[model samples]
Target: MTRKYIDCREFPSEMNCTVAISADSEKELLEAAVQHAVTIHHHADSPELRAQLVTLFHEGTPPTEAPRTA
Candidate 1:
């Protein structure tokens, strides 16, 4: 199966978090991303959150580091 990932730096947040999450499957990636969002970002877990995250899913593994931001 193709790997998938989600990068926090893609979204602008108060913390400017640099975390990048990846998994061998979409299900795994979603679960881990949800946990990170709820615990680290203090976001409420809900269907809406999950939907939004789905849109952010990226194919393949994340880069070794987050892209540089100005």
Candidate 2:
């Protein structure tokens, strides 16, 4: 399976967070992302949050900044 990542910089937030997390497996990435969201961003951990985060996953390493739409 391909490595997956989620970059916080890509999302809008009050802190303008710059964290990016990656893992070899989706399960690992999801757990880490959930923890980061709950602890650092003070977001509630729930099914909805997990669903949203899953949609945000990208293959391989995260870009320094969010890629621009063409």
Candidates in order, TM-scores: namely 0.89, 0.87
After superposing candidate 2, which stretches have Cα over 4 Å from the reference? 65-70
What residue pairs are clashing in model 1?
none
Residue 44 lDDT, candidate 2, scale 0-100: 100
- Across residues 50-69, which tens digit of lDDT does each residue of candidate 1 receive? 99998989999888866666
lDDT score, candidate 1 = 0.91
Stretches off by above 4 angstroms in model 1 are 68-70
Reference-based lDDT, each prediction: 0.91, 0.90
On TM-score, the candidate that comes out on top is: 1
Report the alpha-carbon TM-score of model 2 versus the true structure.
Answer: 0.87
Going through the candidates in the order shown, the clash numbers are 0, 0
lDDT of 2 by residue, 1-70 (tens): 8999998877677887888999999999999999999999988999999999999999999887675533
